[model samples]
Target: MDYDVFDLGDVRLQSGITLPDAKLAYKTYGRLNAGKSNAIVYPTWYSGQHYDNEWLIGEGMALDPSTYFIIIPNMLGNGLSSSPSTTPPPHDRARFPHVTMYDNVQMQHRLVTERFGVERLELVTGWSMGAGQTYQWAVSHPDMVRRILPFCGSAKTSLHNIVFLEGVKGALTADAAWDNGWYREQPGVGLRALARVYAGWGFSQQFYRERIYEREPLGYGSLEDFLVGFWEGLFIKRDADNLLAMLWTWQNADVGRTPGFDGVAEALAAIRAPAIVMPAEQDLYFPPEDSEWEVAHMPDAELRVIPGAWGHFAGGGLNPVDTKFIDDALKELLAKDV
Candidate 1:
């Protein structure tokens, strides 16, 4: 395996169920300074693994390995971590316990502190559900995280976001091949349907109107080609059960749900770190408006809207321009003394 596993033994989840012999799959970049003060935690996003996060890390980028120690911890149901596909029976497949963003960050805290002997995080950042974990880390252990940069994500899953996820869930479950998640083989039909449902919300209408997919980097001749080649192709490699498991985590994410915080506002108020909340202006689900409210409640945060029609994928690192915008913001945030 390219990554290392931190055996968590039997973990009692927030849902009150015990996950037997739980493990966290992670990969580290660079070295922890002698003071262990240069550590940065960059958790994985929905349907993303450690390697998928590498696009934001390189020799001279804001996440440069040479200047800081970076840790990418896979979310629980992302296949590599104690996911439905990897876990043994009983808690495997359809029986995988519901994992919340709180559960994810808690385990990540264990990995960061117990495994690495790190006391303070220089920065905690991510995109999408990974951003949700970023907020969770800031709220759950505010003293430990010095700074945060959450892009194309939110501190709470909006009602509309939850409904959108329902449509994605329904598409997958509608397939007879799914067999209520007990499929003996991959549920190709459901996976494709899910991808189709996702395609609508993943990007802006302007992106389609402009036919950006036909251009250089994407290079698809037609919409069908883009749908089949890009959308379907992406989901086809992922396990149906694993996708659904992570979907549950995404739909239910809320930093306020953490104990002691009454609601999202209170949780946002509790974050003591400097933050840069970046939302894609054209993102259908995670709009800049939602980010505005989050920034309003934060003690030390500013809203920076990503100006583009790439929608949520604007922060997905496909477009070099958007990537540079995000990277530049991170560079500025890291330069600040917190």
Candidate 2:
């Protein structure tokens, strides 16, 4: 609700589908310098909004507002943005067209350039799906960005990632109440099932072995208790159709197919911004090896595995140890000469 909307009428998607009334929801922190060279764009991750992104931002932190003009743009298909749940007829629910991470970065490009008159960016960084957008920005407009830090994500979606996402999509579509995304109400049954699927994959095996779910902030008595009280409760509040749209975008993420690349190697070769590819060691969805492979191909990129048992959720900054690691990495990245 604290964000502003920028309407880009009838935006054309990469698939050649036109999305009418296309808009972007974004929040800005700190004042822009006269030169606007201190700007940083942070795109949201899947099912994440600006609020979730601000946890890692504060005085002297990774995204310190005092020295940087940070812009957090909600990714398309998120409920707060121009998503299936919020868009009007002809493109409502499952009727939304295919959109890629490339499209999302283009919109962010518009928000900063046209709205703020910022031609160059100091940094572009994010986590997970947000990181996907960061990757796209670096490859799509290399000259505009000086640095990029993508955590727990990749420049392209791997075969292993797509298979995991298929399970989630299948679970949601399987419920009778889903009605192919035209449900009269939110599909509670399917959403609950989808939550269960996420619960299984969101954390590491060590997490369960140590019973971390019963720790502070969330003290569920049993596995069922955590599933219903935490997982199910969290996802059922989200729009099912919008979730599907984000999933599709995430599954099909690839910079190789975007304008300039003949192949994945070509895409990696196109990057000019210095990048830090941080992958969580225990993440099954975006394994460190996947990021390692992409880093090997890029001209100016390095791999830094997040050592922890939090899996994909390690980037959330929920645990102190994980938070400190992120802060340290970001501080080091920002201090480097551009």
Candidate 3:
């Protein structure tokens, strides 16, 4: 649907930094039941706005407004929310302090508690970086939530992810237009290069294989045209700086290390919510095995491998069928406990 702004007074970031003015853009669907037990959260993935996750949302879907309340909160680094690119000068990336996934959760906490007056959550769910924050919420505020669904996400951002993020930053920093993260008035060509990097890694070889890549027979153009369409149609439409800021935050997403919470696995093991870890069968970024590792340790966690060729992109759904994947899983989770 549509979202407004959430104002959490004098928000403090994980970088030991504070901003007197903090806002998180978000949207809500359905109604919070009398007991407030119907409320579920669907936080956005990297660079994603609340609208991006609406593909799976419909009248009778698992997250059906008829049955439950769904609220999607935009992550901080995303341009739609308070972020490096959106905030004015002196608050831009170069001067902007680091932000951790915990920082994001803290803001979400304010959104749920203050804005919505939600005392307890039926569930906190998300994909990719959104999933990571869902995990963080489970660990940091165990008693506040009833269940969690983390899709194609990891407990911690891997070193490989970090290195990759650094490379994107390097792409922007190296580009003459980036101006060391100080460019504010104009578009950064380096950011476009960063998006190109995403074009390569965001999906899986399996996704490009066994047919979505094929054309003519399917009635589309040649394979080359499809690839070209993917880049020009998707990447070309997104703002480069916004994408880079989102990428930077995602690459470094680690609730434990960033928050100085050293006992990460222990911390995760203590999550009180019944959890469903949905790992993509073909995902390389946040492998299914990692979710299995997490599920094993969590006091109450289950592993649900999504059988799909979408890989890391197997989330919130790019198409209707993709959307159904999320709908069915959430329906099951909502049925089981929440």
Between prediction 1 and prediction 2, the one with superior lDDT is 1
Who is ahead in lDDT, 2 or 3?
2
Which lDDT values do the candidates have, in the order given?
0.95, 0.89, 0.76
| Per-residue lDDT of model 3, residues 120-142, tens digit only | 88889999998998988887788
> Which whole-number lDDT from 0 to 100 does residue 306 have in model 2?
89
> What would you estimate as the lDDT of candidate 2?
0.89
Off by over 4 Å in 3: 184-188, 214-224, 237-241, 258-260
Model 1: per-residue Cα lDDT over 1-338, one tens digit each: 89999999999999999999999999999999999999999999889899999999998899999999999999999999999999998999999999999999999999999999998999999999989999999999999999999999999999999999999999999999999889999999999999999999999999999999999778999999999999999898999999999999999999989989999999999999999999999999998999999999999999999998899999998899999999999999999987
Candidate 1 deviant stretches above 4 angstroms: none
Order by lDDT, highest first: 1, 2, 3
* Clashes per candidate, residues 3 or more apart or on different chains: 0, 0, 0
Error of 2 at 217 (Å): 5.1
Least accurate 10 contiguous residues by lDDT in model 1: 212-221
lDDT of 2 by residue, 1-338 (tens): 68899988889999999999899999999889999888999889988888889888899797899999999999989988789999999998889887899899888899899999999998899999999999899889989999999999988999989999999989989999999889999888899999999998888999888888888655789888988997898788889999999999999999998786886778888989988889999998999999999999999887988898889888876777777787788888888897
